[model samples]
Target: MTTPRKVTSLDVAKRAGVSRSAVSRVFTPGASVSDRTATKVREAANALGYRPNVLARAMLTGKSKIIGLVVAYLDNHFYPTVLELLSEALEREGYHVLVFMAAHTAHDIEDVVGQILDYQVDGLVLASVALSSDLANRCRASGVPVVLFNRKLEAEGELAVVSDNRSGGRMAADHLVSLGRTRIGHIAGWDGASTQRDREAGFVEGLHAAGLGMFAREVGDFRLPRAKAAARRMFDTSDRPDAVFVANDYMAFGVMDVLRAELGLRVPEDVAVVGFDDVPSAAWPAYDLTTIRQDAEAMVTITVSSLLAEIGGSNVTPPDPLPVRLVRRGTA
Candidate 1:
């Protein structure tokens, strides 16, 4: 059996008795074409079973209408929600997303970004991933717009959209202090992340303002198993903390589980727990974890708008970090 020849736009144009350019304009989004020409092109395309080749048009227009998304990991519920929102927003804008997985390290991200750039993506969004200065320069030279979501770079003028993590941390600390919990402890996330750094800094500043120091501290590295182990170590002692601030909701769930299950500690009575990122699970009755809300929808909106603006030849400034508010629940 022989393979059939693929129908091209020329075939449709010949059948419609219209210029090839008219058929192209009809398929091109936002392109102006007369109603009569469009009707003829549609009828001919249906008869010939000819579909406009997006990649072929991209070669002519120099716009792939594709956005490359690089993510470190999606173990945290917050990231998955953001990913879904970003995908939806881009789809509505007539763009497609090409997702790439990479480790959080600079080297790994650099390698992954190199691969993404090769696809001629119109823009790049780094979610929970950082881009190095060298890689940033290369992307700039290539004229590809880059946006950091839930992440940031030390370099100036990089576009990023994220929740106000520092303020959220301070709010958590204030809430715990107002409850008259003096022996406040903290479960830290990965030391390398900007979110972890800013959140911890604000929490420490709040503690200092109250004339208190951390009763105990342990590094969870943003993993559930590590958080559980850290909880065990923090609570096993007779001189345990009366309250704890967990870095993120994902780790908080583990800390809460270990507190109630392994250590048999009563929450908010024996020890108050506060967490960041009010993920859906945090509101569940089982945990009812009081946390800092990140406003994922707001962040997604800003990220998508900023990225598209940059892609449209607009010089975009990084927007102010989205505001976060304290969510009260049974945990705290």
Candidate 2:
């Protein structure tokens, strides 16, 4: 085999008739170099097959240009939308995303955080962090800036961007109530997540606003089989609810399946239903689900942009909660 060709900063500096510092500054992000000097360095680099060493530059500047993204929402289609947007946005900002996935288990979150630390990422975006208070502290101690999106952690002082979950829930409740739905019920997501808690709170608050209370409710845990079980129990009641609001579209699909096939209930007539997250499947010909829509693309864009700002050594300003809306469809 032929020996690998080695290109170094010294070679570029010699060719450009400049110091090594000039070549280094030319490759460094946001570093200042004279236009003539930069042009010479570029020409010399191209001629010599010289490429900047990203790893060495990171060591020198203490910036990896890598942002770690932790997610716990693979089961929902909404998460994939977020991931796709984040990848594109981060790429544009010259920061690479190092994604780590955990499927709703809070138990292993610390370990995953540890893995992120090992990668020496400059910042972190928590898409669906199942973070305990202690785990949050651990991440803070690691000196990596964290920005939470879609899911908020219990620990205060963590930068977060989320939709107006409560408002979205209330809107759903009010819409169903306006349609003359009286016996209303709820399917809550997993108990631990702050997002799920806020949604449930908002739905309950909206019912109170409508001069009513929930006829029944169950914990769906934001999963399919568990949600189906919750739906089954609620529908099997002697006083079955006329309308139900499930926490997410993925779980809602399970609820609808059980209600139609097993319980033999006609949707929007026997029992109206609404859900959240507005996954593409929600508007499909078969489901046509009316649901709360949190703009996944916008959320991802904000998260990635924020992380890149931190990675670029800029002072990142926290953003306010994004708005969510209800997308109407045939199911309700």
Candidate 3:
């Protein structure tokens, strides 16, 4: 069988009795086009069964109209929320998102980013992951801007949008202390994560300021099973904590399940619990978890705007970390 030739923009322009540039501008997002010209082009395109070749246009215009997003994992409810918000926000600006998952290791992240660069994406966003200096430099050399969402780097000049985690930690600690819950324990996330380190540091600071010390500490590695195990170990002893501050809501749920279901303890009666990241599930009746709100909407807004700004050849100053607030519920 013989193959039919593919319809092209030139065919649409000829059929519309308009210049080829008119058809190009009509198809190009954000390009100037008169209403009459656009209508004619659309009608002609429909008759000819024509669509603009995005890859060819990208090669010519040097813009893929795509943003690459790298995330460590979406197991946490918070990340999925951020992803959805980010996709919506980017789509509003005529850009599409290309998502990739990578291990938390620097080498793995570097490999994932290298692959993203191969697609000629207009910009990059990293969530719950870090970018190596070498990879950062490579992205810069390629004129691809990067924005870190819900994460930060020790190295300066990298753009990031993160909640005030340290303050939130202190808020959790202060709340526990205000309730007269002494011997407060802490369940930490992956220590390598900046959120974990900052939250723990602030919690410890708050405890010291109140003339108290951490009664117990356990690392959960931000995994549900690990959090449950840590809870078991922390509460098994007779001299257990009366209150606990979990790093994030995802781990908080695991800890709560272990405490009530497995350990047969009444929440807030036997052990008051506080968590960070007021994720949607925190408000569920079953958990009713008190937590620090991370402002995912605000973070997503800043991330998309900052990335678009940098992509537009404008230098961007990293915004100050946004504030977090404590939300009281049955858990605490």
TM-score of 2: 0.84
Off by over 4 Å in 3: 1-6, 17-21, 30-36
- What's the residue-level lDDT of 15 in candidate 2? 96
TM-score of every prediction relative to native: 0.93, 0.84, 0.94
Tens-digit per-residue lDDT, 1-332, candidate 1? 99999999999999999999999999998899999999999999999899998878888888889999999889989888988999999999999999999888889999999998888899999998767888988998998989988877867888888788999999999999999999999999988888999999999999999999988999999889999999999999999999999999999999999999999999999999999999898999999999999999999899899999999999988899889999999998
Collision pairs in model 1: none
Q: What is the C-alpha lDDT of each candidate?
A: 0.92, 0.86, 0.93
Better of 1 and 2 by lDDT: 1
What is candidate 2's lDDT per residue for 1-45, written digit by digit as tens? 999879999999999999999999999989999999999999999
TM-score of 1: 0.93
Q: Which lDDT tens digits does candidate 3 get at residues 233-271? A: 999788999999999999999999999988899999999
Model 3, position 137: C-alpha lDDT score: 76
User: Which candidate model has the greater TM-score, 2 or 3?
Assistant: 3
